[model samples]
Target: MSYSIVVDHVSFGWPDGTTVLDGLDAAFPAGRTGLIGVNGSGKSTLLKIIARELVPGSGSVSVSGEVGYLPQNVPLGAGRTVSDLLEISATRAALHAIEGGDAAEEHFAAVGDDWDVEERARAELDRLGLDHVGLDRTVGTLSGGESIMVALAAQLLKRPEVLLLDEPTNNLDLDARERLHAAVGAWQGVLVVVSHDRALLELVDQIAELRDGAVRMYGGNLARYEEQVAGEQEAAARLVRTAEGEVRRQARELVETRIKIDRNARTGRKAAENNRVPKIIAGARKRQAQVTAGRQRALAVEKLEEARERLNEAEQAVRDDAEIRIQLPGTEVPAGRTVLTLPLARAAGDDEQVAGVGGKVLETLVVRGPERIALLGPNGSGKTTLLKRIVRQGAQVPVRYLPQRLDLLDDRLSVLDNVRAVAPSASVNDVRARLARFLFRGDRANQAAGTLSGGERFRATLAALLSAEPPPQLLLLDEPTNNLDLASVRQLSQALSAYRGALIVVSHDLPFLETIGITRRLRQDRDGGLAES
Candidate 1:
């Protein structure tokens, strides 16, 4: 079969001797490939290597055709416009037109020999759902989601033979993510996508899991991979149990034999005081001792060998089960009557009039103590906007909002400084202790928030929000599960379950929501009206 890209014995390591990928070999074909793994499992690093942004320390990567890449966070050049970025291609084409460059034939085929390139560019922008985004608009002025879409559109215009995308759905809402996924699904070229979204995985032709510095391709969807993992884990557990039982049995037998040898030796020594008969007995006792010793040695060797084998097997069984660690501290404050009430809350339209309004009037939505409520809805359904409004209206109640985007944090500040700034009165020792609770201990706390990985930054933000003096009687989280590894998500869920306050979370992860005990459902309509479901 023909391959678009091939990696032969590729190996990479950081300057600090941390091996990210080791002797990995894989081939990407002309179809969607979903790359799934833990947070730090080298998915992004491998993508970077394929994009030529980072060179591997060893091995070789061969590509059959041109490559287009969309990085995790698209860095828009300072003051650059959409037209400025896209016009470069047009300029190159015009130059090619004058000099009869190699690509001139392809350009003429795509557009007529005298076709208006500006019209084609505008049409491309519209096709990518950026019709309203003027070519003159500064890239900096665009939202995170908008910028990502535009970057993708730019790559699509290139019509490369292969495309590499790293967490393209990171900051996108439901609508935008769906649109992007559709565009990718329709592409007729080699596509490699690294993402954690299960919905996105369904669009891929094959799923490749990156774990333990190697890529293993599974011939199925995410659901099938999950089923396989579950079966493997069960098998591993059974093997471990059987091995443990065998070890225990061997230990008991060894102990019994040792005791029997000691007793026989004591009896033989007492009888040695007799005559010739006693000497014969002594000889027999010595022989028995040697036999017992041999048995014991054999048993010991067998036990050791069995244990080593079992350990190796167990390690392999659970190699992919690493979890993230996130601890959200709880406040000591007791919940009050009606933790939050939005009576006839509404947002005005562009004309300064109530575009659409609705009311949820109850005597009290009492969260007596430690009540966890999850807000569920589709994309652009106002889940986040509702949380923000609640925090604003309930100002008297100490509340902390952890936005999906951590942009509110100052990237220049150290993790410690960021936490300290949140609670200025907190002493350095106290701040350090709090940061440690969130897994940012020792020198990690001193690292800049910008330098921390996505998971680390998320934990730091949570630690800062939960470390206040009054300890926020209410916690407002917007898609807190995004970018977090499975382990960290579990840790946060456990902590929130134990919290003695109110929790209002916005998330699309149904399993996580169920784990946290979200009992209420809220739905928003196209007319901007909110209704309890």
Candidate 2:
């Protein structure tokens, strides 16, 4: 069978001697495939290798056609324009020069047969919801989500047979995410996207799970793959129970056989002492009993060993992660208590500007007791700025803000030290115990924040925020799922499940918002107004 991309026995390791992929073998056919895995599992690395951005230490990769890769972090310079990002600057320049009567052979050579490159680029940009973005606009002026969409447009313009995207939806807003989802649905070539976006994954033809240095392909979308895994785990658990029962039964039978053997030996001894039979005949009878007992014992032991092996195999199939579990009674707010209020700013003539988000002015806003509000808007709508303003305003109760950058922890300090810094009243053992619930145990808790991966750093930051001395009664989370993997997102959800506080979260993740039981959905308008959606 023909494959669009083939990775044959690829091996890769970092300069620090940390191995990633070891003799990995995988094939991507001509369709869209969503690559799903936990952070640091080599999904991005594999895509990089296939895109030729990074080379494998050993073995080879084969691609049938042109490959385009959109990295998780697109390099951008402030002075670079949208045209430059699309890689049509030179061609556009040449075309303009020719139009201005400088029709040099070099200009024609550059333009070639693609004179309408600019039109195509603009169309691609418009398709990705960048219709307002101009080719001459500087990259610095565009928001993070806009810049990403522009980069994607550049890739789409290339029209490569094989396209790779890593965390494409990391910085996207609701509208931008929808645009990306549409692009993924419209793609017709060999596409492999490394993302945790469930909506994006739902559009894929297949799901490939990268785990334990290998790839397992499931012939369906994310939901189907999850269903398959859940079924397998259930069967594995049942087999484990069955195997355990067999092991216990074998053990009991072994003990009973041994007891019977002992009784036979005692009987033989008694008969010999009483001279009930000839001495030689009695000795032979005793010898036969001993041999029979030995055989039975060996068979029983073998059966028990087999049962244990089956049980071990069955247990191996079940997958579980150490998730956070803690109740924060101090963080709970009363049902009718006021949590936060935004006072009116004097800048407004008749209408009071209570909050200014991206030049949009909110007349007034109030968040009360145990309310969970989802702050939603497009990128560049000033969600982050509004969050900062809210933080500055101060809450009636203790407030904790988890920024999108996850800058809550000191990089130089260990996870334990970071949490302890926020909760100075807690003892070191107490801090470590709490950190363990966040999946940082023993030496892991002692690791410097600088050394932690994206997900680990997020967890450490969260642990510090929630475990502060004065537990936060008002929690503000900004794009909490930005770079987190699916498992990490789930872990974060698990952690937040125990936080019984009033929350104001800015995120484009509608599914996550629903999961967290958002009581209200607020959208920031282009005119700088906040309204319930």
Candidate 3:
């Protein structure tokens, strides 16, 4: 039984001295392994270390064979065609042919006499669900989902011994996700995938949990891991309560013993002259002293035990309650009869004289109070385009738009400054206080917006959006759950559910949409139009 990959006591930290993985030990065989953790829990970092992109500060990582890594975001080289990348193998064969080495005939034979590398490349593309994509097509022209498929096809062509994927399902539609899942399930190699998708985790044979700079393995899927966590949390809470009660009882007993000792010492001194009384009192004092000392020692031991138990309980509870950080300011205003109304066949202007018209996307849309609408569609299917058009048409209504990217924020400004900038008329102190409510307290408020984590950035954006004077009656979220941890996503879902305003969200997270009460869905057609179903 040979191991595909082995990580022995590996520790890693960023150049900025932020420690992530510590004393982590794990081994991977020829099967699927799911890595689950909270945001900033070092899932990506650990994967990179395995891929040899990042070196560990301590310990060692050993790989038995070639490793293929798929980054979260595929970076395509400019002007590179699918055939150009694939032809590298052919080029190596050609080099062997020119050198006339001992293995030249073998290389030529393996590549075939005619060496139709283009045909082989096309077949590989078809295998990865890119049958429509041309072999000569530039990677730059591909959509987000298509680009991911192309990258995957390139890797599969080489057939590495182990594959490392980070959030591979992100940005993919339901159909594309299913296709990728099938492709991965069929692969014959070691797989280490870092993702929050519960559905995807079901395909894995084992799950590894990363928490507090350590990794632990469990033999099951995400559902089973969640069940185990829930059980541990309940047990930890019970232990904590029990320890607290015992501590309280011991404290009371110690106090009573001290009081009795004081009373006995006073009584012993007062009855010094009485013969029988003095003898009895002296014995009482001796016994009282012994009892007091013993009680003190016992209390110390009990306190130590209780402290250790409480610490263990606290750690377990932290693992159990994985909550996302999302807090929107409460609004007293009720949603109006029509939160948004769009015109039929409206022209969305682009550089080339109105690149498209709204038909399936928007043919007279109207949203009512407290209605959760999910804007579901493929990449470049006008989800964000429809959102912008609605916002422009519904200017009369108070709206809060959280864009997918935080490019709307000023990077140079502090988190507090950004919040204050959103509503300059408000006092700085008041804005800072509001920010603190979102967990940006004290010095954190002074930190630059650029330095904040993905979760913190979303919180800052939310703070800015909610700080408006009249408050927003309609909330527009564009991929709001993207790049957020499971905990943060849950918090955002709960916060949105609590909001009285209407919600118009465009997201790829089906689970999040279902949780946020999206009763209506907007899907886009292949011809750049939306269809409401």
Which segments of model 3 are wrong by more than 4 Å? 85-117, 273-336, 344-362, 392-394, 408-417, 423-448
How many clashing pairs in candidate 3?
Answer: 6
The better candidate by lDDT, 2 or 3, is: 2
> What does candidate 3's lDDT look like per residue over 104-213, in tens digits?
56666655544555566678788767898886788777777888877877777767889999988877766677778888778778999988776788888888888777
TM-score of 2: 0.91
Question: Where is model 1 more than 4 Å wrong at Cα?
Answer: 1-3, 87-89, 92-120, 267-288, 291-295, 319-336, 339-394, 404-468, 486-500, 504-533
Whole-model alpha-carbon lDDT for candidate 3 = 0.74
Candidate 1 at 397: error in angstroms?
Answer: 2.1
* Residue pairs that clash (backbone atoms under 3 angstroms), model 3: 323-487, 324-487, 324-488, 360-530, 361-529, 361-530
TM-scores, all candidates, are 0.74, 0.91, 0.83
Predictions ranked by TM-score, top down?
Answer: 2, 3, 1
Clashing pairs in 2: 360-528
TM-score of 3: 0.83
Q: Which clashing pairs does model 1 show?
A: 324-487, 324-488
Best by TM-score: 2
